[model samples]
Target: MRPSSDRQAPGGGPRDFAAAEWTKLRSLRSTWALLALGTVLTVLVSLLFCALIGPEFRRADSAQRRALDPVGLTFTGLQFGQVPLVILAVMAVGNEYGTGMIRTSLAAIPRRGALLTAKLAVLGATGAVWGLLTGAVALTAGSTVLGASVPLHTDAVRALAGAGAYTGLLAVLAAALTFMVRRSLTALGVLLPFLFVVSGALAATPQLRSLARLLPDRAGLRLTQVHQDAGDLSPAAGGGVLLLWAAVAATGSYVALRRQDC
Candidate 1:
């Protein structure tokens, strides 16, 4: 049988490129390891958050209790879970550049845009599937722990689907940034702090709250909330903001890839 990479369209069509990219991604052990870690973290953190909610709700006043969001509680783990996914996205594209495999890839598939599109498509799909699985598991575990308090309603379903889309968009954004910087560590350095520290800090500051809401992480995560604050954007609008950020990053990455030599 011919080598798998040798099997492609006459000129390496999009489908062929996507197949090759999937093969490459699946061959890496790190991909499975990171995804597994992400799932575990998401579920564990969600369960922990759910466990606390009952006690907290009991202690709270009526107004505070009224403000509680069971659907949102199930996704509390995503704050930690998304870190591994960011690493996964960064490594996916960064590793190729790190080891000079990008040169070989570029040589085999001269159309940089086609190669990038295929890679992003595969990465985005993987992220989405993993995100959905993580969200489902977390929601199930959280519901079991929280009992009747956690409603399995339309909003819950939206939150579950939103969790998947949020993670997928985040992964694409990270990958595109990796492509632009051409270094995994550099991308991680900037992105990790921005997501974890800067975004949270900015969101907490009265002066910066509006600006913070526009951030990709801050805006995208709004999708997982069943209850929105008075000033918060609707889930659909928040998703749009994230999608715009990913698009901008992708465009910048493409420009960098096309202009720079491998």
Candidate 2:
């Protein structure tokens, strides 16, 4: 008889693992709820901003008008909306550990690499779809409210794609960080404050703003803008910077999963 250690997971391959991950994610009510809330907040707040800012925009001084990017305005909610997605992603991974299911998962697969990859792929795919939908709807709503047409220029298309990528990467980052932290609340507690407050505040200071742009949220959000700030990187470059962060986090996740006692 073959040794038990030599046995393969019942249906474990790229396709099966991906399918299993998708099923696990979709089966969770919290996942649906968080995504739904994220969509609503992203679209609704952007629409509201359109209404509130339209008149103010018209009355603003030339300098303020020059600084505005209508396309970017459509997705203003992302600054706030990303929180729920972060929490959802963290919870997804963290809950498995919190609930003592990681042991069963590791027992079932025995391949941490494959399991982590599956989880990330599913989370990324879901976030990308959600981001695309939110971007499209927010832009449409903003244009309608502001009485202007947002053209499908190259920059606009890039913004939409970048938004999707940002959403996907952010989720992946959350999941990775959760694995490294080994606790959902601890991960959430760290991520929520840093991404929301610290990063923004750091980016707002002229002296330190250049340094802050290197952060994932700051760099990632730059893709949504057609115009770059004085010291900002090109949209493509900014996206690349954000990608680097996610990649680093993912590497850490895999390493931690391997080294840590599950």
Candidate 3:
């Protein structure tokens, strides 16, 4: 008889693993709920901001008018909306550990790297799709409220794509971090506060602004902005920074998973 450790379970190929992960993900009610919440919040907040833009633009001086970023304004809700996605990502990996399902998963897949890759692929795709949907709806709603046509120019398309990539990268980062910590609450406790409070505070402080801009959330969001402020990174550069962070976290998770017992 062949050794059990060397045996490949039925349906253990990469594509099969991805399909299994997708099935598990889609079966979770929380996944849809969080995605829906994120979409609603993004569009509503965008509409609210767009509604105020007219009055603000009227009150603005020449410089302020020039500084107004309609494209950026359309995505104003991302800060608030991204929280649910982050929670969703954390829960995706963390739940398995919490429920002691990781062992079963390990037994079925055996290859830790393939299992993690499958999960990340499903997560990345889901996040990207949700992000694109939210971005498109938010942009349309904001444009309607502002009495303007939705911009379908190159920059606009780039911003939309950026939003999708940003959300996907964030999901990957959150999932990798959760895998490393092995607990949903612990990951959320760190991620929520850092993304909302700490990163913002650091960005606001002149002394820490440079350092803050390098953080994953701050850097990633730059991609969704059509206008660049003084000292702000270009959209490509910002995306690269975010990608680097996600890559590092993922690598760390892979290493940690290998070192630890399920």
Candidate 4:
């Protein structure tokens, strides 16, 4: 009996790169763990904070005790949850390069661009699902305790949708940057400090608030809050900035891949 062929011709039939990537994504434990961690952190931490605020916390306007934006406060942990998403995204793409599996992936496809796209699609879809599930659960649980202080309206819906989108985008952008950097620790070191440390510092400075509005996570944070600063960047602008970052990172990775002879 003839042995089965393991090779696919270049530029042949529908590629099915999506299927290939889906298998790879699902096979990884880090992906699922990070997602679960993000959800738990968002829902549990937010709930704990709400409970701590209790009935004693009243607003200056006599609106209601614990009159904070329930929706926003509920999704507050996403700010921290985003860190794991970044780590997961980085590991997702970086693992291939780190393990030299990227060469094998390119060998199977022979078209590096197609391989990258497949990876992007898989990561993006996974992120979207993770974001939606986490946001929904957290919102539902947190709002139950917040009561009438939280409004049920179109604005609230938009904020929930925005949170999901932001989480997903965070994953994609981080993955792209990982591909560009091609090193797990290097990407994490650079991105973490920039997003968490640098952005936090800048946010504290009055003069830099306008500039800080341009930060990636800051724009994403707007998705959870009903009220935004006058100087804050719009969600649309934030999406554009993220897209630009993704594009640059992806392009850089592609160029490096082609030139590095890997």
- Winner by TM-score: 3
Compose the digit string of candidate 1's lDDT tens values, residues 1-262.
Answer: 6566645635658999999999998998989999999999999998998898867766777677557777778889998999999999999999999999999999978889988898888888888899889998888888778653555689888989999999999999999999999999999999999999999999999999999999998899888887788889889999999999999999998999999788
Q: Candidate 1: lDDT over CA atoms?
A: 0.88
> How well does candidate 1 score on lDDT at residue 161?
91
Candidate 3 residue runs with Cα over 4 Å from true position: 1-11, 58-66
TM-score of structure candidate 4: 0.86
For candidate 3, list the clashing residue pairs, or say none: none
Please list the C-alpha lDDT of all candidates, in the order they appear: 0.88, 0.85, 0.89, 0.74
Off by over 4 Å in 4: 1-15, 52-68, 149-152
Model 2, which residues run further than 4 Å from truth? 1-11, 56-66
Using all chains and alpha carbons, the TM-scores for the candidates as numbered come to 0.92, 0.91, 0.93, 0.86
* lDDT per residue as tens, model 2, 1-262: 7566645646558778878878888998989999889989998888888888888777777677546777788888887788888888898899889999888878866889988998888888888888988888888787678655654777678888888998999899999999999899999888988898889889788899888999899888877777767788888888899899999999999999999787
Task: Please report, as a residue range, the 10-residue window in candidate 4 with the lowest summed lDDT.
Answer: 58-67
Task: Please report, as a residue range, the 10-residue window in candidate 3 with the lowest summed lDDT.
Answer: 3-12
Error of 1 at 65 (Å): 5.5
lDDT of 3 by residue, 1-262 (tens): 8666645655458999999999999998989999999998888888889898967765777677547767767888888899999999999999999999999999888889999999988898888999899999987777677655567878778888999999999999999999999999999999999999999899999999999999898899888887788989889999999999999999999999998788
Order the numbered candidates by lDDT, best leading. Answer: 3, 1, 2, 4
| Highest lDDT model number | 3
